[model samples]
Target: MVRPSPTLRPLLLAGLLLPLLVGCRYTYLPLIPAPAEVALPTRVTSAALTREGGALVLRARVEGRFEPGYLSVAWFDSGRELGRDSVYLDAAQREATFRLEAPEAGAYRAVLAFGGNVLRQVELYEVEP
Candidate 1:
């Protein structure tokens, strides 16, 4: 049997373990980059309600390219929810319109929402012409 010197034993052990340690080093790469700040592709710029031919028409100015989603309006009178209406928007859409029954003469509020996110609130008043 042959015995290695103390210094040579450590060197032999290091030689055997060095390759394993080197192989164990991990190189990590992120699959996705960090998020960047960007504006939404579709947004409601303005909204209004008008009475036409005994009906209320909701017109919402949708600015930017329309993504396929639902643009909705929730009608409220005196802080009580009255009704809700929505229009399906596609890539070819540029504006949103919702026709609703004529509300009684009173002060009302209309909330415009897109993709379930509230975008704008409009105060409406209906009076006899």
Candidate 2:
């Protein structure tokens, strides 16, 4: 059997405790932004939500000569842009999905835009305990 030396024991202990202490010190703020605007050029086939690896995933079905598309998930209410992530699609795709980070459990929307124009918007409700 091998045991860590006295000097090495402290470093190992500190490394393990550092993460625990850091985790407790951090604060998580959920997205509670103002209502977002809805302007659509055309409606896409469908937009829905599903759970993937414990994360909120927004999936959209789109088509046509979009060439370029944008996917975003945002929360809004009381007039503010709570939290949002907008990413450009590699290209126009029939099925696209974006994962929402630990957003505060609240009302949110997933929107797909093609060439700066929204193709679909779907409402989402995050159930929190």
Candidate 3:
């Protein structure tokens, strides 16, 4: 029978134990919960246009982790739907921003849809000339 040299024996032992040590080190990491399919908007803010005769730009910040899908933006003016814009997100993003130009001088609602669900809805008012 042949025996491994002293230096080679220690090297072989370390190679065998490497995987066990790495696995145990990661055992304490808590598993993060999967984001909900339908997450409501957590925070929202709106501001009026500062310049006169400038179009009102409604900006919104929506927070959620949506599945790989398309996000749609809809603009509503005075309880009536005006227009919509859609964008595709291939991977998960922590948040998203949407902007819509004011159609007329009035109150407007911006709705964000993700995976066929309404993720956020915000209201803004446009001043008249």
Candidate 4:
């Protein structure tokens, strides 16, 4: 059987504990800023139904301030994506308008993506028979 010398035993113990001491002092740094507050659209001013056409006219104003970067809009129906659009903004825009045709009646949701963050807003409408 072989045994470490007394001097070597303390050195080996210190080497193992050194990693633990350093690891305990370690902290994780955030890579990006935390999500900021996003304001939901206040009114659906241009939303309406027309008897002349089978499609429903949908329009709304989304108001919010976000960090300047790539922005995207994803339109959803009952959690399903119907369409999406993307835009690049160097400066923050407080308001934007979106227009789309509603082929059928169902619940709809809108999601805004900026950088690595996402904000969601939802609305529901029904078509008359």
Candidate 5:
């Protein structure tokens, strides 16, 4: 049987442990922001949330020329999802509105998403009766 010499054994052990120690350190690279030209087209120009009596209303103004698609507004309460509402967008439609029953008085957020990407979010706090 062949065996490593005493001097070679220490070198071999150091070689293996050196990589383990060095690899344990992680270096994260900073994210590069996307250029404005390559950014997603702004289909929704503005969105607002309002409470009307017993319902929450979402009014989003859309401005762009794109193929017909669906825009969705998902309601969340303290990180728990309540429900989602979607509206169809045609070429001629200039705005989208969604009305949903208001949840119990609490903090809520409405996320506006299009093409699987989030475009805007509106936070609303409903006062207790």
Candidate 6:
């Protein structure tokens, strides 16, 4: 049987412990910008665009404190409007979601808006049937 030297023992111990000590650090920085600080139109909290199956879903949240808001999404292909859908949200409901389907397999753009403010999302969808 052979024993490691004193210096080699410390090195081996450190190598074994390094993995356990890796992810235990958290740095606090007060200068970071949060999503709340951004300018919001009509007090809308969040907007999301995602593709589900062959349909595109757009969602927006309008806080109850704000007035009634309209959430609308327009589908565009090749700079032309293919279709649009909208929903009205009242105080009782703070969120609105809309789903629209693409006509064919290709790239398409979705324009999401709440009243006068607009946001755009682009996605490439392929379908096989």
Q: Can you list the residue pairs that collide in candidate 1?
A: none
List the lowest-lDDT window of 10 residues for candidate 5. Answer: 31-40
Deviation of model 2 at 51, angstroms: 4.4
RMSD to the true structure for each prediction, in A, is 8.3, 22.9, 13.0, 11.8, 11.7, 12.9
lDDT of 5 by residue, 1-129 (tens): 999999999999999899788988757655565566643475678888888887888899766655678898998777888899898887787689998787457777899988787889988877431
Write the residue-wise lDDT of candidate 1 on 1-129 in tens digits: 999988899899999999889988656767576899776666778788777776677888777665688888898766678799888887677578887676466566789988777888887766322
Candidate 3 structure quality by residue, lDDT tens digits, 10-56 = 89999999998788755544577667787544332332222134344
Instruction: Report every candidate's CA lDDT.
Output: 0.77, 0.62, 0.60, 0.55, 0.81, 0.68
Ranking by lDDT: 5, 1, 6, 2, 3, 4
**Which prediction has the highest TM-score against the true structure?**
5
TM-score of candidate 6 on Cα atoms, chains taken together: 0.51
Could you tell which candidate, 2 or 6, scores higher by lDDT?
A: 6
lDDT at residue 46 of model 1 (Cα atoms) = 78
* Model 6 stretches astray by more than 4 angstroms: 1-44, 119-129
lDDT of 6 by residue, 23-93 (tens): 67765676685667554445556766677787777777665344676767787765678898888877687
Which sections of candidate 3 miss by over 4 Å?
A: 1-53, 58-64, 92-97, 127-129
Evaluate model 2: give its TM-score.
0.47
User: How far in Å is the alpha carbon of 112 misplaced in model 1?
Assistant: 0.9
Off by over 4 Å in 1: 1-41, 127-129
What is candidate 6's CA lDDT for residue 120? 47
